[model samples]
Target: MGTAILSGIISSQGSGSGTQEIDLLPTRFIACVRRPESEDAIRSKLPREAPDSTVSVYVKDNCAAAREADVILLACQPHLYKPLLLESGICTALKGKPIISVLAGVTSNEITHQLCQTAKTESKGVYDTDAFSVIRAMPNIASAVQASSTVLEIHPRPQLKGVIATAHAIFSCVGTVFTTKPGNFAACTTLNGSTPAFFAMVIDGLVDGAVALGLSHTEATQMAAATMRGTADLIMSGKSTLDLRYEVACPGGATIQGLQVLEEARTRAVWMRAMAAATSGQSSLKEGLKMSRGGF
Candidate 1:
């Protein structure tokens, strides 16, 4: 997800017509990984405005990255959060900084709790200062192509307005950005991440069916993908799903016959079940906390 956002930001900084879009290009980007060998992978994603911007990749040195960054992104695996803050000086360096975390199922409060655990203050039970200004986001791999459907958790943080706008600008470069109440975050996360993969699966099946019906695989794939994009555009433009479906399903039409086949098999219900299963195990905060104790 982090890599996709980097690629998207890089791609968004330029236009096909050769004009540079400077506003989308940040002055620097820092990416941290677990190994020095991983540095090249990040280097491969350098921004289009490289000379105008600098990218520094770190190996197992997130503390250094945190110290230098005005905005911090926590892209580590969910379970690694505990250890991430365990790095000496990390929690202190991050105090009151704007943080954007893409870890699924981890909340801003959970992250703040972890940081407080590490940076126990000399004063009574508090940090003697404000907690990290954190933003929770759920974005997908499609961000690489600038078509990601990203969600940002919205909570009352009157002082974090500037940070919120920064978060929005960064994400909007990757795709459409939607802000929803934090209470709806988990449901939105379920819809944000896996839907793209599910959409791809639908396109894949259509391509195979097209192949079986005599179209070349490559050509069928292109047509199916284009149709999917067009359909999404129509829906986004306020066309109701039922209206679009019925509009294309004329009386005695092939489209309606195909729709009947899907209806008989309960395809829509199956899709709903798949989505439900995605987060079914994450039914409680206890479960999420347990999972948080286990990743990278």
Candidate 2:
């Protein structure tokens, strides 16, 4: 997910005049990771046009990277947050920065608490608990293709104004950005994070059906994908799902006949269940750290 967002940002349109918001787009990206080999691994996967000067990789040095960045995006695993924050000079480097986190189920308040914890733990007693303005975001895998549905938790505090704009500016590179209350973010994560996999499953099933009807796999795959894209576009353009479905499933048409099969199978109900299950899973995830506790 972190790599995908990087790819999208690297693919961003070049610098623009003050008239366009592109001027606010990131000019540099610094990714900090624990392993030395991971640096090359990340660089290898990015867009070919991404220059070494534009993107820097920090090997086990979060403070150095955070110090150089204007806005800090926390993309590391949730469990790693504790150790990452505990790094020497971490809080000091993050001071006054707009911190955006992509950690699923983790709240900005929780992140603030972690930063405060680190401030107290630093060997040098110069502590800075008010280190950042937090923006919690969830950007999906489609960010690699610049079509992600990103969910950003919106806070209306005056102190967070700059970070709010920064969040929009940064996330807009990937795709649409949706703002929701902190309370709604967990539910919204289903749409931003889980639905892509669900939609892919639907596409897979559709393609298989087409293949079963004797269409070549390649042909079926392309057709299904294109159709899905067009349908999504229609919906985005304000066509209601029921209206769109009805338009295609004309009276006594083959579309309606096929719909009957799916309708009888309770496909819609299954999808609702899937959504509930995903939301439930996210709630559990946000409840607390559950991943590996191993340090960086």
Top lDDT hit:
2
In angstroms, how far off is 275's CA in candidate 2? 1.1
What lDDT does each candidate get? 0.77, 0.81
Which residue pairs of candidate 2 clash? none
lDDT of 2 at 50: 83
Q: Candidate 1 lDDT, tens digit per residue, 1-296?
A: 67777777767765432114335336578888897877776666555555434677888888888898888878877766777887888976798788888877778888887778777742236663257788888888788888888999887868667667777888887888899898888778778886777898999999999999999999999999999999999999999999999899999999999999999999999998987887663444334355431121
**Model 2 RMSD to the real structure?**
3.3
Assess every candidate by TM-score.
0.88, 0.91
Once fitted onto the true fold, the runs of candidate 1 whose alpha carbons sit more than 4 angstroms away are 16-25, 45-53, 121-125, 281-296
Number of colliding residue pairs in each model: 1, 0
Worst 10 residues of 2 by lDDT: 12-21
**Model number with the top TM-score:** 2
